[model samples]
Target: MSAGRDDDAQGAGAPGDAARPKVSSVLFLCGMNAIRSPIAEALARSLLPPTVYIASAGVRHGERDPFVDAVLEERGLSLGEREPQRYEDLEDGFFDLIVTMAPEAHHAALDATGTASVQVEFWPMPDPSVVTGSRDQILDAYRDLLGRIEQRIRQRFEA
Candidate 1:
């Protein structure tokens, strides 16, 4: 995969709009930090406001899947700061918004983070781990997830 930067995917409006407090830094939650949440983090951090932080966590803890690294490398975001931390590891009500990549995580984040005070978005994403077939088949699902995240992040910031 080409490892450079995903900033080109943005419109001229990105830099100006990423500063919106309605969006701000986001926390992406999933069943695991392995796939969906990680992809969301990578895409959002790269395409949104450079100062706007993006982070991922799981309802349950697990190792950071290597596929997440490979996919994000293609999009040019460093995985160095992503340490597979759980939501409880951070303070509550810290993020301006929370994005749940799966329904299970939506429920979990609802319970764990008490998101009623903050914006919570449920994306209902499928687990990329369940993908079967060739490598491209797997990469395609990941790329598709990235596309969806990019769109949503743009919406939260620009619209």
Candidate 2:
């Protein structure tokens, strides 16, 4: 969710009112980094300022999905040559927020961060890979997922 500051009792910017801590780094997590999490990471990187660090990881490493690449290309975004990474493979383990799009990822994040001050949020996104149909219908499912992720990123990060 969007990080917000509480106004001072006196006024909006009264003296001695410390601003709330902003989310400087975020991790988008899912069962497989191939789709949802990667999409979120790319969108957040594009939407948020450069000062905000964004990354994505999965509970287990998965092969990159071509559908993800196709949909991202439609929006002028790309993951480049990046491959899906597992949570344990992350180069940097610290983040201000860890947004899990899958139930498994949420559980894993909570378990991994037990007793740590990290914030974890479960977003409950559906897996587009589960949609079996014609090529057009499958692409539509991916597109729908892409739209949902974009909307969520805007709601949670953009002013």
Q: Please give the TM-score that candidate 1 achieves against the real structure.
A: 0.76
**Which pairs clash in model 1?**
none
* Every candidate's lDDT: 0.68, 0.81
Give the alpha carbon lDDT tens digit for every residue of 1-159 in model 1.
112111122321244654334555788888767778877777777777777777888877888777777777887776786677677776654776677877777777666544245556576666778888999998888777777777776765662
lDDT of candidate 2?
Answer: 0.81
lDDT of 2 by residue, 47-148 (tens): 889999999999997999999999999999999999999998998999987888888888898778876777676777889999999988889999999998
Question: Model 2 off-target regions past 4 Å?
Answer: 1-20
Residue-pair clash count for candidate 2: 0
Task: State which candidate has the highest TM-score.
Answer: 2
Q: What TM-score, over all chains together, does every model reach?
A: 0.76, 0.86
Tell me the deviation in Å of residue 61 in model 1.
1.0
Per-residue lDDT for 59 in model 1?
A: 79
